[model samples]
Target: MRPRSVRARATLGATAVVATALGAASFALLGILDGNLVRGAQADAERQALATAATAAGGGLEPVLVPGRGIDFLQVVDARGRVLAATPNLSGSPALTPTRPGKPGTVRDTWKRGPVRGGQRHRVVQVTTVTGGGLVTVYAGTSLRQADTADETLKAVLAVVVPLLVLTVALVTWRVTGWALRPVEAIRAEVAEISERDLHRRVPVPRSQDEVARLAVTVNATLDRLEAAGIRQRRFIADASHELRSPITVLRTQLEVARAHPDPALWGELVSGALEDTVRLQDLASDLLLLARLDTSEPPPDTPVDLAGLLREEVRARRGGPVPVEPDLAGEATVRGSTLWLSRLVANLLDNAQRHAERRVVLSLRVDRGRGTAVVEVRDDGPGIPAADRERVFERFTRLDDARSRDEGGTGLGLAIARDIATRLGGTLDALDAPRGARLRATLPLAAD
Candidate 1:
């Protein structure tokens, strides 16, 4: 089957609806007019019959016997069933009996012998006298031609008007659809003109506060996000390349220096320094790769996990430390997530706490009663992060100025990785200001049945 054009489909549907409504209205009007016309014709025939009966009853037979202009036939019968007078055409028939006297009666008797042009169905009216000896009847009729003619005329007009109406409606619908979609077409053309090279360009926003305007706003917002993501991707690539180049250059220079030096110990020391740089570079590259995968990968695996148990295990694993460790775990806090990733997320926070705490580190995991959220908090007595640098510390490769020396041996990606994993699990990781030292909290959604 051939596919139908959208414009044609829209126009056809609109036309069909309008035509159906018009057709129904016309049919109802025609029925009412037909009923009224038939009723009026019946009333006129009855009036003529009444007048004829009255005239004949008031005088002798001659006036009633004469053929009246519009009256088809007339007959006067006495109470004893004798015809007083009738028109020539109806004279041969037997004298009519008074079925009802002194009152009106109707019958569907035929009148072939009338002065009317054609035989037709008619209503008969009877008149009776107070004296029991006499009665009068009058007959009048109309040909069905007038009613037939009116019907034919209506049919002919409808034949012409209905098709014309359908055509006019189809045209109007087509024009209206085109007018409605004009803005959408313009938006499509403008969007086609925009490419990666011209992301600064935007589609024109329509002034009207309609659905089309809302659609345009949504499209513009999507475009803005794409542009921002593209810029971030370019920056990430440039930064990665710059970071990788430094260690590579240092390794190459160290190798060259060792090749030129004759002292074995000096050469060994240079080699060891190069090895350490190589290890650091490797760790940075691995962390970057992991961060990239986390951003782009699907949702984490959903498995039953006792979060309190996981925290206790992590705390026990780090039993020996410069700082005293205390853990407060309560409730059966079960969650759904990748165990490996969740362990890494928890481990990163604990390691950061251990490295910076002055004397004590406290870890706690429990479900918050009011909010119904699973909260895991790690606090320490060490110097806490300053308010100005708290947000910056979660970014990749960001380090505190006080801990920038090579001896720190941190890749500065620990908090970044932890935050990314937390986000993927539909949780939040944030630093909280504490009186003694820094406090970090990870809040996860409570598992719902």
Candidate 2:
């Protein structure tokens, strides 16, 4: 079977419930009206019958009582049970005895006479009267046709009214349901119009604090985040292009110069210069790729790593001369991250410190307080970064003018890559002010069990 639409199903359900309740109420009302009509008609018939009986009683006893057609049946009996008078179409002696003189009685009964085809069914009202020393019993009954007609009329009215009311209810329900869902439809249309280029655009928030308005607020907040991310992505791309273009241009120019001169002595120097540019380009490209991958990849694999062990190995591998070193592995200092990325992150911070420090670089790994985080601090005796340029130093391709000519062999991406890796590993890197030089702190989330 084809699935029903929500509107149809909802409307149908409402209609069914309302129609059933209304139908039941209608049936009950019609029954009550029919009963009341029947009772009123019977009372009217009884009053008319009593009036006819009274008229006959005022006349002579020998005179015959004749009721008009369609009004009632009339009969009179003496004390001996003899039928003294009756209407023309009625026959046979009266079955009931005459009532006592000076006394009155009333009763109801069904009277049937003659063959089935010619017979008539009636509801009779017997009125007894005392007359002449004996008794006379008079019967006057009205037909039930009027009461039946009233009942049928009530039924007809119900047949028309019930359907009309149901139709009205259905139409009203459909319109009201549609009106209630109008806001949702508007929200959907507005959301469809939004795209990446138009992340600044937002869904209209209603003034009301209803659920739809809350949903709009939430969607707008998400769009705000997306817009910020897009801006960052654009800035990153622009910065990457500017960083790559300079080295590439220099390499190309040096190669062109060597080609034009064709001198072996200068050729080697030009090739070396080109090779240096190529290495710089390669480092820049690799860092950019790593940053991109880290931004898109899953959460880093969290494994327990000994911060002190990793630091010892990195310090030993450093080509730069280290004046003095101290290792203080306190509280086990275990953290969670991909060991390879975490090692590179620490190695970068150490390398940066090693390049800048004049005499000594102190490494520390320890956990303080109840929090399960490993802190790796690399403090040096060299000149520290200026407080104003601390944050800028972590940005890609951002090297201080003085450090630009320093023989650090860095592509200026080490700190940027370190920060990216730290962020991905649920950690952070910051340059702290120290007595002699800068103290770089790298904090990573500790491994659980």
Candidate 3:
């Protein structure tokens, strides 16, 4: 057999259960009604027999012999199972029932098989009477044909009506289920039409604030996030390509010039210039690769790193730099983060400050034990960034004219990388207002120890 659809199967199963219940109930009701009718028929037969017996006793049995009412069988016997008087329809036959006479006014029910009445089933009532001579028995019976016919009619009607009712209910249930699922189907169709290339498209939310509507809203929100990520990815690619092209173009031009003129005197300067460009390109590519890795990298391990020690080391390492760096270390500042990333963050700030400073750069580290934070600030005596461009300074490849000149050995990605690394370590980096220069501050969560 072919498998049925959900609606069809549900309808069929429900209808079958209802039909079975109704069928059983119908049968029980018919049986009860038929039993009551049979009992009523027996009672009527007994009543007729009693009336006939009373007439025979009062008027000597001859008037009842002429046939009274519609009782089908009647017999009078006197103690020996011998018939004393009978209706004309009996034709001098024996007693119709096997019930014997007992105490006066006692009645009993019995079944009789008749010869003259075509052997049909009859419900017979036997009544005992005490007369002037001896105790006599009176039998009365009626055919069960009429009650049987009524029961048969009831069965036929129930058989037709129950199935009709079940079918009607099944149809109504199917239609209601379909109507409720209509919105879900619409959402499925709309979602099917969406593709990755058009993540800007959104699923339609129904007016009702039910589960299906909430699902559509959540799907649309996810699509919005994907669209934003796609835009950022495209912009990153374009910017990277533009930045990479500059060095490659310079390399190609310098190689072409060196190839045309093979003068030994120009070769030294050309090689030095090429080496510098190559180093700059390498540093830029490394920074870009680190940023890409950070996009998918797991959270850094939580290891206690002393911020004061790291700052001191960074300043000592840059001792040979052209600008003077003033260190203001207050206490043993500790934070929770990867030592490498935290060090890189500090180095980026120091490098930016060193590059922009004309005479001096200030490096400060302070531990706020009560606040549970480690704060690091690098201040430069260079022309400070404007208030309007403060937030934009941390964006990738964003460069102010005085801060990120080509001759200053700055790739314009240092601050961006530093901010990203700081965020990953549960810290924040921002530029603060300075009187004569730029002040960059980084705040990191303190280590438990």
Candidate 4:
């Protein structure tokens, strides 16, 4: 069942249980009331019967005893069960009850009494006393019809009212529950209408700051993130296609020229150009794949690697002319990271520095044992990057200078990859401001000794 429907049924069920309990309590109270009325009738009859017995013992029953105060019958009998005196209603009849002596104030149930037969039940009280030098018994009885009629009336009233009360309570509970969940139903409807393509749409928020409103806020926030991811994915695809098309077009054009000219020198030039474009294409495809893997790949295993030694080795392998590599690696600087990734990070930094340096590229590595960090810096003396462009330099396919195009041996992904790897390795890489040129610094946690 739906949530609101289940809530409605639960509310109805609880109200029904309460109504049933109240009905049962009311029924029990009625029973107590009916019993008390019958007891009061019996007490009055006993009092009247005792007075008649006293009268017969001292004087005569006909002058002292009176009837018809809610009592049905009265009789006096001697020890041999012969009627001595009785009210007019019980005239010429035998003893209504046995003349045997019983407890002083005991009431008994009798079915047949003093010519009144047909098994009609009556409440009787008996009193015994000495009269005319012999023992005599007095009985007073009353019909049970009035008390029984009252109990039946109460029962009938309860039977009608209890069900009506239960039904009314159940209906009221159902209506209240439905009213409470109306906002939740509205939120569900609004969210249901939103498709994947309509992630920009938000669920309607209620005015109250309850859980339902909070839920609407959370859902809308999730939609916002999904929309941003969608936009980024579309832009990434377009940029990748644009980057790939350039190399492929160049390769096709070079091959076509070689086919049409058929000159030996021109063939050599064409082959070199084609090979360079092929290498560029392969590198771009590899960078894109690595980025995709970085997005989903688990963190690499950590191991101790000498950061200073890695920097020194990358600097020594430099290919360009007139760019002197100066190293200021002070001591053993080791950090916890994957060796392959650390090597790539240093190579990317050195390559970027060598490309921009006029005549000198400086590499520095040091470990601050007090701070528990290893710092590596690559500085060059070429045109410095502006402060506004530092952060953008780490974004994919971003380049500040249009003159320094892809043909200038820069893929525009080296810094982005380096930053991503450093982050995964629990480190940070940033472009720091320098006096004359650019400085890129990487900080990583030092390995435990």
User: Candidate 3 at residue 8, lDDT?
Assistant: 68
Colliding pairs, model 2: none
- Flag the better candidate by lDDT, 1 or 2: 1
Q: For every candidate structure, what is the RMSD over all alpha carbons to the true structure, in angstroms?
A: 5.5, 9.0, 7.7, 7.1
Tens digits of per-residue lDDT, candidate 3, 238-351, equal 878987898889988888889999999999989998998899899989999889877876877688887788888998998979997899989887788777888889889988
lDDT of 4 at 234: 83
Instruction: Give the lDDT of residue 317 in candidate 4.
Output: 80
Q: Which scores greater on TM-score, model 3 or model 4?
A: 4
Q: Can you write out model 2's per-residue Cα lDDT over 120-192, one digit (the tens) per residue?
A: 4445667777655456677666565554566678788878887888888888888876766566677778889
- For model 1, the stretches where C-alpha displacement exceeds 4 angstroms are 1-8, 43-140, 144-146, 149-165, 321-325, 355-357, 381-383, 386-389, 400-407
Candidate 3 whole-model C-alpha lDDT, 0 to 1: 0.81
Q: Model 3, poorest ten-residue lDDT window?
A: 62-71
The whole-model C-alpha lDDT of candidate 2 against the native structure comes to 0.73
Q: For residue 439, what is the lDDT in candidate 4?
A: 94
TM-score, every prediction? 0.76, 0.63, 0.61, 0.62
Scored against the true structure, residue 382 in model 3 reaches a CA lDDT of 93
Rank by TM-score (best first): 1, 2, 4, 3
